[model samples]
Target: MFLGYHILTKFFKNGELSNDSPKESYLYYEKNAIDGDLQGIIQKLDYLKELGIDLIYLGPIFKSKTTHGYDITNYFSISENISSNSEEEAKAIFAKLIENAHKRGIKVIIDLVLNHASKEFDFDSVPKNLSVKTESPRSPQEERWQMSFLFWNLDDEDTREFLIRVGEYWLKNFELDGFRLDHALGLPLNFLEEFSIRMKKIKKDVTILGEVWEDEGDKLKNFNLLKKFKGNDAQRFTSMFDFATYDTIKEVLGKKNGSLLELYNQIVLSNQLNEKEFQLTYFIENHDLPRFIDICQDIETFYITLGLLMALTGNVMLEYGNEIALKGDQTIHNFHESGRVAMKFKEDWSEQEKKTFNYCKNLVDLRKVHSSLSSGSYELINSEENLLIFKKKTTYDEIKVLIYTGEQAYQLDKEYFDLISNNKVLKLKRGIYYLQ
Candidate 1:
């Protein structure tokens, strides 16, 4: 039942946009770190524990030209603008940050952008086997604003050895818990296997999460793509973030045409509970997608989706600004700024923001106390009209979840305990209810 939190390191503070570069060097300026003074994340460690997070997943921190460090120029050094320190000083600061996180019982994993590097990378440092190769970009709108990246030659042995050492370096030097491999879809199976093996060898319990989804394709999911990451007990990725199910959740919001059954079925078929070799991590929002509240439109409906997401039988991650319903929209012109907004704290929260934060905190706390909600197995009990019911159970503990996402009044079959309100009731409508 533990929760994971994702933080876009640069835009993590409230006044982040104010730190944009004074003199533009590229198509767009840096968001929070261009000769800037925004405080580093290590100072805000207490904020994570207050939200019931057990693991912290960070966006890229490597040296790069853009605000988002996905196009890394140097894997060995920490980004210069993130702090006021020199290159070597920043690495030492990062290592100490990991030590403090371990003391607080929070595991830390970072994004590993293996597919490409900033064209600014010094190529002479590596072997002569590599060459300059530029492929067509993925998202068309951000092309002009984005930095030109040099695609890696996965077929080359020297390239494989070079990238793998990058993964091993962080684990060995910083005692990092794991990595979330960015853009991991349809990678050569052999390279993926070798990469996973090399990472765990540095730390046996390292978690390697893959971004294996094709939302541009369809909701049915590409088992052909996912099968590449699924492996045996000896060597395999620890889990995958469930973008397919999140797509379905988006459909059910605001009395939409979609049904929760599609989401349920997607999970059951994704990696059946009996198959322990792989697992899925479900999230309502992330740095890439639009904010959950922005999509829900109604405050109550936003809470309903948040409740439904947390109730699923898998791991969950809460992006940094999501606790207070932060807003961002991806588009052709400003795609990165769309979702990677600065985080808000308690001192300056609106009533709706406070409610959303508490509602999320309550759902997280419920999972901690209820065993069935955490490690228990899942089964569909009922789905009639707007009401869909499911059960989570172990041999001794059992809990049932009732959700009403349709418009108009709904009736309860029996007296039920509303986990959200902490009260018993016999009538319910358009909300989430968990009963023992």
Candidate 2:
């Protein structure tokens, strides 16, 4: 089968990697930046629990040189940069956080950066025969490609086995649930198959999510390629983040000029791959993209996007600040001003902001309570210029979603319960609403 209806995932980065926290900055990779400590994450477990987050896809925590731990220096150690603690203490604290997260019913998964390593990564640790070093290939993600990474030679059996052991080390050592393969596209399909075969043997239900991106025309082609990652007896990835769909959503909601019908059409296109065969993950913002509020430039549009994300049929992920509507100007090339905005604790928000954030809670709860919103089939009941009415229905449940970007009022043919405020209504206006 696939993920349960109640599963809600999140992209978690601890601390404010902004100029506001300057002392923790990396010497070479970033300036005017500071990193959040693992200790600080322990205090936020309750917040994630309250938000109904079932799984958290954490940023890289391996020993690294930057605020975002993608360029790992060591595979077996926690980054001392994240916390002032020694590596041992930092790792202990991380383990404690995972332990606590599991206790609160939240599974934890960190980025698995197997494609490359820091320029500073000690090649001495690698076998001489396996050290077929090469620069990271030219990529659309120029910032990463420009940074000069030491790419792994996956063709070498010793290298693949080394990486496999690295993944296994995390699973066997930490109580970690699984990993988000950093650049699954960079790894060979056979390697992914083998990695899955091994990782699953350690934790049968381990969640291995991949980050695979392809162009619009290649969307279905990418889906078919993802299918190859699985063998007849074992599966490779539980889900993958589809950047094509993410880009379409970003264009429509962010620029506020893209077609609503086109947006819905993208979801319908992606729905073809859903269920037992392939699962896609959707989000409003992540560490890599510009924030919803910043790009949309309108709070109302941001709210509408959030509702659509929750109501859609697929896996759901909330970037660190998305639940409270943190705005950022983060680009693929940089992250100083926006992407690294620090966590806003519950006490940090004003009553109105807190109330608005709780509205996010209600939205997630709606997904969990209604299989129709999560696992059900999606159908467009009606549509117009900037307004669309859709329904998600399964054998046991059904829910209607009304999302409007226009000011026009719409007439309803039947009364239904307002799933958000738990009220009843027979009419609708310019807003996002979920009903049963």
Candidate 3:
């Protein structure tokens, strides 16, 4: 029952500029060096602890052209401009981070973008003259193999083999606790199954979470599409990002259909994944979407939304820059890097933002204290126009009943204490009860 953040630069760096290219270049430089300034990150360790993040998932610190380095250029190297990019220096910083995080009882997971390398990476440095050959429908054999990527020619066995080796190299070298794989659906199924098997041998308890944005059940039915990871295929990678829930929310919101209650049904129904699928990475937004605050509009509702995710069943997650209410524009153009704005901690947070932040902290606290939310079975007890009743029950003693209020506030039994507010018992039978 831990909350997670994708990027932690805020804890280490200072004065992140918001302007375009200069900021991007500055980010590149800061990331390449290890000494940029990590006090900001250090100071926030306790803050994350307060929020109950037993783990934090750093997106990518490897060297790359963009500020948010998803496109990994050097798998073995840290970004040079970042103060600790030198091998020794980077290891030292990583050691300290691991030690500090462990002391706080937090686990660290690094994002592995094994699906593709940045087109900007100096491919010439590699042993082979491997590069994208042509961008057309038909090209020479060598040319096509060089350029084949996630969306295109990776169908080649040699290219897939190279990618698989890259994954294995990281597992053996870095000793990473776990990996949050990027665009897992695009990967060759056989490769994923094999990679997961080899990586697990290195660390028995290592957790692997796949970012499979495809429709699990439907897609898998079409010739096993390397989609669903089940049975022997079950890599240590146990969970998946719940894009299904996010999509449903968008649909519900657009049609202005069913209350928040209906939304909850959609979530629980979607989550009825195969038993092998152990966890669900739940979130309203991430590096790819508009900020949760911007989407919800009402800050209070945002807090309630977070409470639902945290308090409901399964493993939940919060993005790296999500805690401070970081907002970014979502567009098809330059959409990749532009989605992740520098995290603002000192000033941009609104009062409502603080309230939502506190709510997240409290909800995380409740989840850990109440294990039923984590390991228990979830049931959708009731569903109406705007209100849905869901219950989480564990083996022994805990039972959490969730009431999701959509656009309108509904009434619930006054006996239940509002978890957000300390255990102050309420007496009113029904009065605008949204999320409690």
Write one digit per residue (lDDT tens) for candidate 1, span 182-222: 87763567888999888877888788888877656455554
The Cα local distance difference test for each model comes to 0.71, 0.71, 0.57
For each of the candidates, the C-alpha root-mean-square deviation to the true structure, in angstroms, is: 3.4, 4.2, 5.8
Clash numbers, per candidate: 0, 0, 28
Instruction: List TM-scores for all candidates, in order.
Output: 0.89, 0.87, 0.78
Better of 1 and 2 by lDDT: 1
TM-score of 3: 0.78
**Which one wins by TM-score: 2 or 3?**
2
Q: Which residue segments of model 3 deviate by more than 4 Å?
A: 8-12, 15-43, 124-158, 214-233, 253-262, 274-277, 329-339, 346-350, 404-409, 423-436
Identify the runs in model 1 with alpha carbons over 4 angstroms from their true place. 14-27, 30-39, 124-147, 222-224, 271-274, 329-337
Candidates by lDDT, descending order: 1, 2, 3
Prediction 2 TM-score vs. true: 0.87
Of 2 and 3, the candidate ranking higher by lDDT: 2
